[model samples]
Target chain A: MRTTHVGSYPKIPDLPAPGRWRTAAEKLQRGEITREEFRRVEDEVTREAIADQVGAGLDMVTDGQIRWEDPQTYFARRMDGFSIDGLQRWFDTNVYYRQPVAQGRVAWREPVTVEDYRFARSHSPRPVRPVVTGPYTLARLSQNRYYPRFSDFVLDVAQALNRELRALDAESPPLIQVDEPAILQHKEDLALFREAAAALLEGVRAPVALYTYFGDARGVVRVFYELPVEVVGLDFVAGVRNWEVLESEGFPQDRRLGFGVVDARNTRLETVDEVLRALDRVSRFVPLDRVDLGPTAGLEFLPRRAAKAKLVRIAEVKRAALEVTR
Target chain B: MNGLPLFPTTTVGSFPKPPYLLEARRKRLRGQIEPEQLRQLEEQATREWIQRQEELGLDVFVDGEMYRGDMVAYFADEMEGFAIAGLVRSYGNRYYPKPVVVGPVGRRRPITVEWFRFAQSLTGKPVKGMLTGPYTIAEWSFNEYYPTRRELVLELARAIHEEAVDLERAGARFIQIDEPAIHTRPDEDFDLAREAMEIVTDGLSAYTITHVCYGDVPRIYPRMLDLPVHQIDLALKNEDFALLEVFRQHRFTKDIGLGVIDAHSHRVETAEEVLDGIRRSLEVFEPRQVYVSPDCGLKTRTIDETVGKLAAMVEGARRAREELGAG
Candidate 1:
């Protein structure tokens, strides 16, 4: 089994002093430092994040999303026809994201995350997966003033993001992850999500993983499997009902399973036996080799130390699973 | 209520602590300073904030919540059956030690009453007793003990009920229980929030207020009025008072703590802007039904920003009252 991060590692390292990234960000806001100077500090932290993932023995890693303010604004700020607005709570967590307001038909201006992916790929020994906040989630989370219908807005966002995905695909990364945690909240939007997903992955040549978290995707699991993606990631911790759905309906053998066994939202670490038990159950349908073990959601919800420890635990689980299989 | 002005001005609790107090808090956390030393500084900061409010000509006052950290964690730290956990992100570049409920939760004693009494003693104006609502405490915490959220919330409601009663006994005229997490899951959890609030506000003599900010306000608009409180404080300025349209559609049933200044922005609002906000609010709410305040807590802003925002808010309220011929 391979181990990987869903997306987003903690920005701050386990340090006594305030993190340099935070300090530099404040300095940049205050005009005390140039944008170039602040970006250098961000680059340093990005390197550290990739190193952290590599040190934990993950097969695939990311840039840790250290430079991102939050998932929504990171893409919304870069794209056209959107304005970043006030802070809104992100799901049930204590964390908040700046809500994106769509003023007109959304369109992709240029590649947003390609350079970051290149930076991560250059710095890491492990394969780096470029993660994009999915169009369905972007449309769901945003306030739309331009579109007459919600479907129109979502499809437009999907068409816009398809360009970004094509750009990332050109990099020839291991896999691309599209996060649509908002889908589980609105199950009826599956058809619309399918339309958007189709548009988003239209010309992308790289293998893609569609990941959902924060809640169960039992209602949309079948629809999720129907998508033209190589992998389907679901949260087994917060989205426990996905387990029941998996046991009853069974997973498609053709698609790889992104087994999210680690709880990224909570500080509690899972033991090897606990992870092994879950692996045994999931391995019934999807073979162990075809599964990617990782946390349920982004590790940004956790402290740096706990997030690192969780990563180490996932690596340990992978080793233990290998031993059990042997 | 009769003693208040036409457009009564107040804060939604929490002002930015001075640099020395922030340093003292840090020292106290590292065990470099005694509890009494920290308490003294907290008192000093509270006194200064109360004096500042009086000078700014606000009708009502809050103790500024200088002795607290995260609103949920503060009560969790004082109450039984809770252990503070590792850092969790609250927002952009903001983290707080999340509280985990480990056992049967109970309040050993009044959490904010002593702070309320201290602040009240320093001022002649009525100081609002501030407490984080039970729904918020339960929603924000990691519950390991309670089988259901309702049970834990009700237990917390009972615990906060004790605190509210004590604050009323200590001569608090207004008690603001903040439930910022109420609107997070409006479909499933809103009723539970109202039930828990009823348990806290039942038979309490103090004018009750619930402060909710930065969530799906439109989703829970008229239904939020079902919350058993005398007033609902909202972050209206940040949303450009767009909620007024909803209020106009479904008549607002309770007093509104009209947010006239944006608390999160570093740029201080002009008095004209604040006045414009107050004027827009008056279109939907009567002057007496409106209470002027900042959008939310001022702890996120610097001391200068907080002062500038509040000064502008007070000036705008003054101008609004004059226009209404009630100054």
Candidate 2:
């Protein structure tokens, strides 16, 4: 059995003088602090984030995407041809993401996630998986003013992201995660997603995992299974009906499956037994070794304390499941 | 119905914050500035916004919500039995303290009354007293206090009712209860939404208006007309005038706030585009029953874009008034 976080740990508290990433960003904006100084704090926070995950005894670790303000806008601001405009409420959540407006041809100017991933890889004792917001999601979330057709936009973003993924792939990380939560929203575009995902994962040396959540991906799971990736992550908590899809499709024994047992969207703490029970249900589809346990989505919605506790619960649930197997 | 001007122009509350105001807000948040100092800055910002709207020839105006922060959090913080949670990202770079309903929700004192007084003092034109609607407050908040969602929503409704009545008592003629969250999840129980709106606007002497943005207005229609407000402000420009067909298809008796300018975009709307939107809306609604406004709050926009959009909206409304021969 393996343990890991999907992405985004809660904002690390800057106690004594409390502050969050927004606070730091505000300071940077006001010229009260410099970009170099802001980055120094981010590095400090990122190190603590990795340590928190390590302390929880995760096998496949992620950088927690602590620096990403939110998934879509973070990348939107970095990429060419994407201008982030007003804030749009992120789905039904209280959270929001700056609505990305594609005014021109989407192009990758530089490696957006490589340095952050390298920093995380250097700090972690365990194998680190760098996560990127999937191209399909970027296309879905953005208001495309340039593209005549939506598929053209998705694939264009895919090509742009392909450049970044290839750069990260050069380092040969153990795994790379492409988050496509928007796939559930755009099931009609599955055929297009296949092309986009293939292009995104092409020429990449590392194992690629495509993850989806926020809705049931059961209808789209078969399409995801067909994609060029080593692992498929599903939201078992939110997509409770996903179990039926797994039973019908039957898990590919050779491939990996990420079981999202923890509910990251809500603040409620899932009991260890509850997680163990979900894992038991997951076992029916795939063997324990093939399974990766984590949150249904990023833990950004949770407070720092609750997010940490959930990590501890995941560790505890994994140990309990492992002991039972032994 | 009340003989309001043909193609009346108003804002959907908030205007763009000038850089100095944003800086002042950041300083206030950091505890570098005192509460009085922050209030002075807010007052200054509010005055500037009111003056701008008057200059733009808007028939009605807003204080631009300068004294407020997040719409829900601002009210939640002031109310009893509500606790403010940590800053959660509401959108890219923008954050709001999620309100957690931990106990019985009620108003101990006036929330927006004093702010309305200050804003009304600034402008002879009627300023809308803005409040977050009960359904949105209940929806946006983490509810732990009430037994059911209905109960929680009703409790919030009662609290808002208090604020609305107080605003009326404070000599404000227009009060807008914003319910931006209602249309987001259209599948959810809307009876609770209607019940809550009825409670909030019950017996209000003020011209009751409700603004719902970034949602599918057509999905909630006809039933949405059942909302107890005198006016319904829909983000028509963002919906790309799609809801105009819905309005035409259905019998919409009440006044409609036609959002001719897209508030979400930073682009300055051309007066022609705004005029086109107004003309389309005029086809569906009587000119006297249509209020030309921005699709949503302009807080997210830059000052120049906001000013330009409002100017276009007013100019478009003026053109519509001339075409309708209502002058």
Candidate 3:
């Protein structure tokens, strides 16, 4: 079994004096630090974030998205014709994001996430996966004043994000992950989401993983199987109803299953024995070779220390699961 | 409810933070400025919002929550046995420090009363004392110390009761307890949240109001009626006046804070649109029971949009009053 994480690792604590990238970004806004200084800090923290996952014994890794203010708005800020405005609540969570406001025609001006992925690759011996905020999620979370229809906005975002995906694919990472947390909430728009998602994954050379969390995806799990992706990740921790889908053989047998057993939102630690048991239940339906064990969502909700500890246990559990299957 | 006008116009809570005030907050965070400097800035923002509400001819006004950072975190910072956690995602990319209950939750001092006094001192018009309800605080936070969610919420309820009573003693005639979290998990936790809310508002002498925003109200009704509040405020306009049917079906006995303005949108509601919403709500609620307001807090909107929306709301309420033949 392979070990991986959903995406975000908790921010590396600034020991001695405590702060994160948010504090640094504030300083940059106030002109207290030069652009060069800010980039240096971002690069330094990104390295620490990567090390957090790599040191925890993971086969595939991410840059921990340290520089991102939030998943959606960070990309929105970097893209053209999209402005970050107003802190809208992210789903029902206490965290907020600057709502991505579509001001004009959406287009990709330059690479948004490629450089960060390259930075992570340069530092780590393990393969670093590039995680992009999926087009459907970006469209759903945004305030679309310019688009005539919501689908028009989703398509434009798909076209824009496709360029970023192709750029990252040029580097030939083992996998490219597109996060679609909004898909679980919009089951009625499954047909629309599939079209938008297909547009996003088109012409990508690397294997694509479409990840969903924050709610159950059992209602629309069948829709994801038909999409042109190699991996489908479901949050078993939050999406408890997904187990029935698994039992009913709803998951596609041809693709890799990122089976999430660890609860990322809560701080409690899951023991290796417990995680192995969950994997055993998953192994009944899916082949062990096609299964990747990981957390239900990003680990940002927990403290850095707690998140790291969770990953360490997950890695140990993955090893134990592999031994059992072998 | 006494001496209130027919279809009284007010805000749920909060107004937009201008660019300067946002900068001041950042400065205060970096220790570049003193707390006194930040207080001066907050005072200036509060005065501007109060003056704007007065100019717009609003019946009940709020201080716009100029001194608060996040709704739940602000109270947690003031209370004992609660510590602010690292930034957790509430939605999209907007983050707030989730409060962690480390010990018994209790109020050490008054949080919003002084700010209430300052804003009430400025205007002859009554300013509603706004607070984040205990259920919302307990729901949004991560409790490590408490044994059960119900216990923690009730503990938070006791702390919040202290703040509500303090606001009353500070001469606040109208107090709005914001419980935006009640909209989530209605099937399992609705009764628990309602019970906690009753604990917060029980025995309060002020004219009590509860604002539940960005939610489906019809699902939580009957249970919502048991909140022990004098008024139940909801974002009716955002629902496109669908809540009128609920009000009509259930027959609201208490006052209704009808939200006629959409706070999440950049498009300012025309006075006609606001008037239509108020008229539709009046079909279900009595004119004396109607309190016209926005769907939620105005903090997410631009300052210009906030002012324009409030002006339109007041104008619409005036039109509704004229049409109904009630002054």
The candidate maximizing lDDT is: 1
Please report, in order, the local distance difference test score of every candidate based on alpha carbons: 0.89, 0.83, 0.84
What tens-digit string does per-residue lDDT give for candidate 3 at A143-239? 8889899999999999999999999999998899999989888888888998898889889889999898877777788888888888999888778
How good is the docking of model 1, by CAPRI class? Answer: medium
Candidate No. with top TM-score: 1
For candidate 2, the docking band is acceptable
- Candidate 2 residue-wise lDDT, B239-275, digit = tens: 6798878878887889998888888777898888988
Pairing residues by index, what is the TM-score of model 1?
0.92
True lDDT of residue B220, candidate 3: 89
Give the CAPRI rating of model 3: incorrect
Maximum-DockQ candidate: 1
Better TM-score candidate (1, 3): 1
lDDT of 1 by residue, A74-155 (tens): 9999999999887888888778899999998799999999999999899999999989999999999999999999999999
Clashes of each: 0, 4, 15
lDDT of 3 at A212: 88
lDDT-based ranking:
1, 3, 2
